[model samples]
Target chain A: MAKMTLEELRKLREEKQEALEKRSIEGKDCRIIIGMGTCGIAAGAKETLSTFLSVLDEEKIKHVAITQTGCMGLCYVEPTVEVILPDMPPVIYGKVDADVARKIVKEHILGKRLVTDHMFDRPAADIIKQDGGR
Target chain B: MHIAITDYVLEVVQNAFEANSTETRVVLQETAEAFAVTVTDNGKGMSEEVMKRVLDPFSTEEGKHPHRKVGLGLSFLNQATELAGGELTLRSEVGVGTTVRFTFDPASIDTPPLGDVVSTFMTLLAHPKAGSLVIERKTETDGYALDRKELIGVLGDLEMSGNLHLLKEYIASQEAALS
Candidate 1:
């Protein structure tokens, strides 16, 4: 099979940009970040990240930007992920495998409803504060 | 997640970075008949016992990942490599880090697509722990290599979404030029 072509990439970028514009016009922006720290990767964060990317692409839901970060000091929450919606606090979800990641994309990201069951109880700011602003 | 071979390569790179590697080198070589990828890292390598257990589909270190009961990356890659009539090799040392190399017959019926490597590289560039990354792609006709430092100098910080897009364009253009 051939590698992805430049044209395909251009189209992908265009689609994503259009999605972003559409969201911005509605006055909102969203970002999804997956933790890829050692524990995270060991727990399958790589696959989780891949799952989110593929899900977002398959759904053609472009308003959200997908990114990755190191361990959030939540080792027990290997494969931890954070979702930030427009004007809302960042919600961190733990034990996120492929299925959980898909749900986060479909429900939390596109549907605008938080998945309370899997979310970390404390908000991101509180966690940062406890860590002394690392 | 279902994806192409290149995405799996990116997963391996992520694993290397997670190990706190000071440097990671990825080499992808493609010929008319075969495709090969190798990732080497300079981080804390695994012990022999750990390395032996890493290949088992049922064995993953506890506390490493929250919910996963197994580590399937190597096992899955091994299956794919063998399905393509190729082999997977892993070498490691206690403090020297690890190297994972695999090859596949591109013409094999079971071989998967190469996927979007440009995006994979861009994603790696965005990782904060990615100290140094060198990706080289080669074919019988041409080849090109990208260094992280050079990329940062040419396109600015990859953490920014705008720069990530620019970096992807740059890589895609370069790969196109190679072909």
Candidate 2:
């Protein structure tokens, strides 16, 4: 992980300010997730999330913000993560280590291609209702 | 009630570990009318300001940046307790320690049926190297306490990996007896 001084942390926070605000907005379509359950943390979701945040910082992807959530109910395959794109299907990926997290950023977030193997497909009925209709 | 309490206990224990606690104690007491659960940790404690915001569901501590963005664990626990006609209390002093207590009215509509507490306890014990978690469960007539150090001695040299299934079964039976 890259160590950021107070100034750098503030700068990074400033640079991502818009993205963060956008995420907080009620109707925006963004990919957001984190599994911080005991099982997930023990499985290393912390490092995985940090990797994603760093990648987002490095890539400077706007309009998409990452956030943390609790357990997704699957303890066996932990460090579980989910990605939601606008008007599209939400994909949940499990066993996400740092390497997998980087892949998710590069391929899913940037290339706009869902990584099939790691993708967790939810039944349509269970899809979380986003702020907007999307 | 069961799921909420279970989730709250799990989250609180995790926080204890995150605060660099070496030893933690959890106690659950059940009566005909209510259930009381307490978790105490000898970790790097927090200040009054941090304690005030700890249950806000939004404040993030410095070391917790990587693990959380919207701090919801304690908040969620509080909500769960409230919905169950229970109360959640937290006490902490910097450089001293922290303790969280949950008191629940057992018959409330929001209370969940107590589920597999033993499994949660087992998982904590399985990771003894990270820290020691002691769980005590009490009812009017009897009580049970599990200490990881004791289990380690029982297993002796034989890897828990190999005997995990057997251990799990033993624990299940013990839980059934308690229930």
Fraction of the real A/B interface contacts present in each candidate? 0.00, 0.00
DockQ of 2: 0.01
Q: What is the C-alpha lDDT of each candidate?
A: 0.78, 0.73
Instruction: Name the best candidate (by DockQ).
Output: 1
lDDT (10s digit) by residue, model 1, range B1-179: 63589877977888898788979999999998779999999988889998889878898767878998988887888888888788889999979999999998987988888888777877877788888888899988888787887677654556766558666777877777776
| Docking level for model 1 | incorrect
Report the C-alpha lDDT of model 2 over A14-132, residue by residue, as the tens digit. Answer: 56455444335345457668788889999999898788877777887666767777889877888999887775567788889999999988888778898788876563564546533
Worst 10 residues of 2 chain B by lDDT: B156-165
DockQ of each: 0.04, 0.01
**Model 1 lDDT on a 0 to 1 scale:** 0.78
Cα lDDT tens digits for candidate 2, B1-179: 22646666777887888888888998989998889889999999999999988888778796677876788888877887798898999899998889999888899988766666766776666754436677888897867677656555454321333334334554565566664
- Candidate 1 per-residue lDDT, tens place, A7-84, comes to 554455565664334323233367677888899999999899778878877988766766678888889878899787
Which pairs clash (backbone N, Cα, C closer than 3 Å) in model 1? A43-B65
Error of 2 at A19 (Å): 55
Query: RMSD for each model, in Å, please?
Result: 13.4, 18.3
